[model samples]
Target: MAKQLLAVAEQKARQMGLACDIAIVDAGANLVAFHRMDHARIAGIEIAKGKAWTSVAMQMPTANLAQSALPGGPTYGINTTNQGRLTVLGGGIPLVRDGMIVGGIGVSGGTSAQDIEVATAAVQAFAAAHTHHSTGASRTIR
Candidate 1:
């Protein structure tokens, strides 16, 4: 599953002409697999991992936290609680199957939108691999 996720993200990154860092984490938020495309930003290595970790830890897409993490929002400063490892960015997505979170995927080294697109493709691939339904049709995916 991790390998498939990495392959899907890598393909998306290549399609967008981006060199990206991709990370996959299991349900426990442990790193399962990772890939750094040639010339990917050095800073993206940890950021990608952090994004995956944050998605699993928080049980939601990291993009959902962006606005709430802002000052005066419900989750303001929440990013500071996880030893500064939490990232309220758009690149992380939770992998869900049968209404349960199975893992997470994170991408970096592109614009937030591009990163989100790549991660989303990976999640869609995971969904397709596990079910017969159309990809990205899962309610747990957001």
Candidate 2:
């Protein structure tokens, strides 16, 4: 899964001409794999890990937390409670299998949209691999 995720993300980032820092985390938010593309922003290293961790911890796409993490929002100070590991960014996605989160993927060093797209590639691949529906539909995918 890590190899496939890295290959897919690397290809996507290359096609888009953007360097990336990609990280994968297990269900417990433990780092499983990581890769930093040439010229990727140094800051992206930690951000990528945090994104994956945040996704697994929250069990949702990091983008979905953006609004809630804003000032005055219900989860406004949520970031402060995670020991500074929470990242409500656009590139983090939880990888679900059989209705449970199996892991997470995170991407950085690109625009928010690009980061999401890269992470989505990994999510899509994981979904396709675990497809259960006979009609080629994934039970845990969107």
Candidate 3:
């Protein structure tokens, strides 16, 4: 699963002509697979991982997190409280299968929306692959 996610992400990154740092994290927010494009910023790797970890750990889109972490939101302190492991910015998305979150994908070193687009593409690719191999049916992962 980790390899599949990484492959799809890497492919998308290449196709989009964007250098990126991609990370895949398990449900526990542990790193499973990671890749840094040849020209990507070294720092983006960790940031991407942290964003993905935040998504899986919080079970919400990173964009939503960004909103919640605004100046006066309930989770404003989250940015400083999670040991810098949580990022409220965009680029992270949880991967769900069979109504269960399997892991997450994060992309960094690009615009926020670009990061989200790549990560979302990876998730969609994974879903399509899984569906193609299972009972000739398809399922949507929320």
Residues 1-142 of candidate 1: C-alpha lDDT, one tens digit per residue: 6887899899999999999999999999999999999999999999999999999999999999988999999999998896899999889999998999989988998988999999999998887877754454454432
Rank ordering of all candidates by TM-score, starting from the highest: 1, 2, 3
How much lDDT does each candidate structure score?
0.91, 0.89, 0.85
Candidate 1 ranges with C-alpha deviation above 4 Å:
132-142
Residues 11-81 of candidate 2: C-alpha lDDT, one tens digit per residue: 89999999999999999999999999999999999999989999999999999888888999888988887
Q: Is candidate 1 or candidate 3 better by TM-score?
A: 1
Of the two candidates 1 and 3, the one with more favorable lDDT, higher being better, is 1
Question: For every model in order, what is the number of clashing pairs?
Answer: 0, 0, 0
Tell me which of candidates 1 and 2 scores higher on TM-score: 1
Query: Which regions in candidate 3 have their CA more than 4 angstroms from the true location?
Result: 136-142
TM-score of 2: 0.90
The local lDDT score (0 to 100) that residue 45 gets in candidate 2 is: 97
**Root-mean-square deviation of each candidate, in angstroms?**
4.7, 3.8, 3.3
TM-scores for all predictions: 0.91, 0.90, 0.89
